[model samples]
Target: MPDIFFNFLACPLGSYCPLATLNRNTGICEPYSYQLPPGQPSHTCGGANIWSDVRSSSEVFCSAGSYCPTNTEKNHCSSGNYCPTGSTAEKRCFKLTSCNPNTASQNIHAYGAMLIAALATLLLIIYNCSDQIITVRERRLARSREAAAKVVKEKIQARARWKTAKEAAKKHAVELQGQFSRKFSRKRNITVSDKVTVLNEEYTDTDGNSYPSHEHSTSLVSKKSQSASEVEEIGSSPLMKMINEIEEQTFDSSESFSLEIKERNLKTKKAKGKAIHTHSQIFKYAYAQLEREKAQQQQNNNLTFSGVISMATNTDYKKRLVIEIGFTDLTVTLKGKKKHLLRSVNGKIMPGRITSVMGPSGAGKTTLLSALAGKTVGCTISGSILINGKSEPIRSYRKIVGFVPQDDIVHGNLTVEENLWFSARCRLSADLQKQDKVLIVERVIDFLGLQSVRGSLVGTVEKRGISGGQRKRVNVGLELVMEPSLLFLDEPTSGLDSSSSQLLLRALRREALEGVNICMVVHQPR
Candidate 1:
């Protein structure tokens, strides 16, 4: 709502203010109008310093009565008295009486005219202060509004935190429940099956001894051939026979239940394995499995993969900078969320060799590279990066570590040669003459094979200019002109074709051979 109207005595204190006024002025509270020039911030008075804008961090506090005095013209009260209406030399507010003592009959008429004048003056005072009064009300209300908004924002954040905690708790509970069920819960029940016929073997020749004592004739008892007498005897078995029957029935029930449980578990496992998986997710899971197999086969290989790659450039290069950088237990973590992005990563990059760090997506590849280059200052880094086996300070490390980001940050308008020349002049030593810088740029251009697109503009993505691969090479050349000892490239061939990527990798390999330690993050190796 627009705070165009002002209420009297609604400021910090309920006193007669030269500033505050009534919303609907009718011979009551007076409001002053003070028009501000364009582009000036409007200030509202809240009893000298009672209320202010929330963003107004710098609050000006004043001693008692330092700013505005009560009910004086300096205070802009218009009337000399604090009381709204009265009759004294100051109280005859705006009333004027005629000086006609001789005409006593017209005295009443003159007094009435004087009263009208005073009332008119009061109205004029209130009208003049409308702007100031409205401004003060708005400012005071703004303070309250901002406070309310802050509360709402905090509540929303708290609610979000609570919701996240709830989800985490639910997940933990479900995991615990599943673990307990697997570890402790009985998976199958033992129950008696339907009626089973007991087995019986009979040898009539052995019992009688008179039939045939020579070779006993074996005969199987047919259930139908048993007489009613035999059936009754089987039912009314001995105690031992009854016990055997009961034990057998119980054992059979338990075995059948165990078989049922095993079958159910197999079905469930097959269903879970049949669940759909995205390409990346499947790759991650399969990669974990492959890692297990590799661990088992760890003894097969005697050769070790070195974290450090030593490079000695071909003797042809005039200036060879040997930069050996090693990191021990490098770690990076998020501030507010306490999430560890890079955890205890250790590696080494020495001049004259290309050491590529390959990993799946979201493996902290970029974070690790940026941290080594000091580009990840926003994150909390806890590790020591040693240069040449010594603890080199960040300032010195930054000077030597040349990093090429995934995105090309070159000026789109400048030509390829011009870009390299300017970059050389900026990073090259001041002691080196202009010709020296030019020579460095020329040498970089010649080696990188960017001479074909030297004069051509490195135009915008849509505009005509050099090819994507050439532009990328120019970006590298811009850094190469600096003659940095250690170079870090982050996914340099990310958006390039297979051939372009190989060409880029080859150029880096050549640089490594020349003794510039090159470390790059590549999605895959050729």
Candidate 2:
């Protein structure tokens, strides 16, 4: 009984064990299985501990046949290498002593108590550190989730912007079609040029007309300005009133009329007809336009025209700048600093071409562009600017000209799409619908290849944003959305890479091909 008590209290390396016993004679620990109660079958299990105790009867550790195994058979009573006490890892043989019935019971108890204290200390350490490890892992996972969500949001915004642009493009197409239909259905066609009067004058015989001797008035126009008072004075003149009352013939400088003289008229000899060099294409286009207009008027109650000019009216006249800008003896002197920017600078900016004013950084390239564009407000500008054979007035042609300065300013907080949309609204007429403005913005976005980042914020120096090249394009696009005929760009390729510069120049050339006279002040060779 004492042996059982001693074996139960002691364990391997003096650790406590309840299901094992120490064997005597030879040193080894073994399990003690409980025998079944009388009349109770072993197969019939009951409560959990009672079942485990019943199963222990069939197993023992380091016991062979009827004797305890040798140190060789049991693998150790070794020195220096300690046994592992882990629940599931491989365990090595441990140093052990022979067991006795009642000897050294107190020493076993003391070592067993120490083992329990060490195990409790290890468990306390693990419990304390677990919270810090869990917190760090959770923070890493949270950062990953936030990054993923940001990418998804950007993708969604890009898709929505693309959808809006597509819809606006479709609506603009329909609007253009309706405009063409209305414009073609006109009865008395209006002249392409405003404030023009045509009067074809021909003379009859001297006796037949009895007026100024003339076969035909070939002069395109008289120096007399057409005005309300001029028309009133011509109509209320005494000579005109007297001639109308007596001879039944009245003449006005601006009017065409005829009178008859009975068989007493003189004939004027015909002058040699000048060989008119009219290009067939231009004449054919003009004639075809007139014929189509007549047909549309006849068919649609004098409300529409047909195929434009001759081939087709593909050009949007308002959107096209067809001016041939010529400058003579242009000079700019800054009176504030008494600096001469340009001296006797003469140049011509032709239609469908790119004109560059190249010079060093401190040169007058920008000054010349400002002078020709009439953007030099405070500076002394002495130049004559002629647009398509007519002298352009500084006040009148200001709207027709678009200028993008070197330092292109933009709102940083707004997105790329918003920036462009606001620019379109600012320049387009109030009569333009919201959709029309969106369409213009979309066109500018596509032309500048900004569709990918259209939803991105235009960040500034203090914040993150697009690349420098893209921002430069946005600056140019703001002016482009206005669709002015004549466009001036100052250092458009500034802060751009080679490929981006190439693309920007290509867009400018494309605009020039569409009849916009482009003038650029570039420092680099463009």
State the lDDT at 337 in candidate 2: 92
* Per-residue lDDT of model 1, residues 1-526, tens digit only: 2223332224332122344433343422234333333364463322321233223321221111222233322222223222222111122222343322112112247677778999999889888888689668756644543454455456657987986875565556556545644533332111111011111112454465534422212211232233334545644556335445545655776689636535644654553366434333332333333233233234223423331111112132325668888999999998888889999888888777888899999999999988888788557989889988888664675665688988887878888877987888788788864434544665576456775677688999778788888888888877788887789998888777887676677667656655788888888677
Candidate 2 residue-pair clash tally: 9
lDDT of each: 0.58, 0.57
What shift in Å separates residue 305 of candidate 1 from its native position after superposition?
25
TM-score per model over all chains: 0.39, 0.40
In angstroms, how far off is 354's CA in candidate 1? 0.7
Residues 239-304, model 2: lDDT tens digits: 445434433222241133222211112211111122323233222222333333334335333323
